[model samples]
Target: MKIIGIVDTTFARFDMGSAAVDEIKQYVSARIIRITVPGIKDLPVASKKLIEEQGCEIVMALGMPGAAEKDKMCAHEASTGIIQAQLMTNTHIIEVFVHEDEGKDEKELAFLMENRAREHARNVVDLLFKPEKLVKQAGTGQRQGFEDVGSLRG
Candidate 1:
């Protein structure tokens, strides 16, 4: 089974004959073909054609150009700081005007806020595992979904 997945051309140059490419050649079999696209915009179209021509049954893709990369930028500090910021802002605005942990309930609320942010980060990672299904269109000859994070955020 030959499988094709896309990668960012800016981040890595893909070679079908290279050892790394050979390793993921296929999700199931020994034969695999990895094609590097100039950008994320071209992955789906390329995969669709490859699926038809190469008889690719499953297309498992990976591109960490962004999503997870966000976490790796000062992982330790951001994890604590971002959540703390969210807690302080949301607590006063939404929950109640409690900035510091004076009571047991306030401390628990702060803890919950921190956990929620951490969970949000985990969700970000979970979604990053996919092409980010944002908008979907269905027609007689074409079906597509756009997952570009930049476009999604905008």
Candidate 2:
């Protein structure tokens, strides 16, 4: 059986990790491990630990950056760290970040959080079990939280 890690941040108001778990369970049978950290910056190490120590094949790093300049900067740094961890581990860490400012209201924000998490969770399943499914959709402008813009090639 495969192991999928969900490393989320407590700073996020929505339970994106749960959304992801629910989505993944719909497709395949894999051991899902969940880890909670304090903030976005902590996602890299936590996800890395999940991969290296906990034997996770793929990880979802979920975070919600506040609607502020500093928060955006921190998210950027955390993203960089996530990328580095992925390179070091030679594994995929799907960064699921929903900026607080992306939505105009709480309802919209929650919707985006859930949608993005669920969509990425499906992507994880594809990466683990069915890469060709994703390849078939390449350049299709498949947005997670919002409406897909569709492929440019008509």
- Candidate 1 deviant stretches above 4 angstroms: 1-8, 12-28, 67-154
Residues forming the 10-long window of minimal summed lDDT in candidate 2: 145-154
- Candidate 2 local lDDT, 48-112, one digit each (tens): 99999999999999999999999999999999999999999999999999999999999999999
lDDT of 1 by residue, 1-154 (tens): 3233322233322221132233333222334445655533344444454445665433322222222544344233333432443343331100111122222564454443343323322222233333243223112222111122333223
Pairs of colliding residues, candidate 1 = 25-32
Number of colliding residue pairs in model 2: 0
Q: Which run of 10 residues does model 1 get worst, by summed lDDT?
A: 91-100
Candidate no. 1 TM-score? 0.30
User: Which pairs in model 2 have colliding backbones?
Assistant: none
Each model's lDDT: 0.32, 0.97
Model 1: residue 91 alpha-carbon error in angstroms? 45
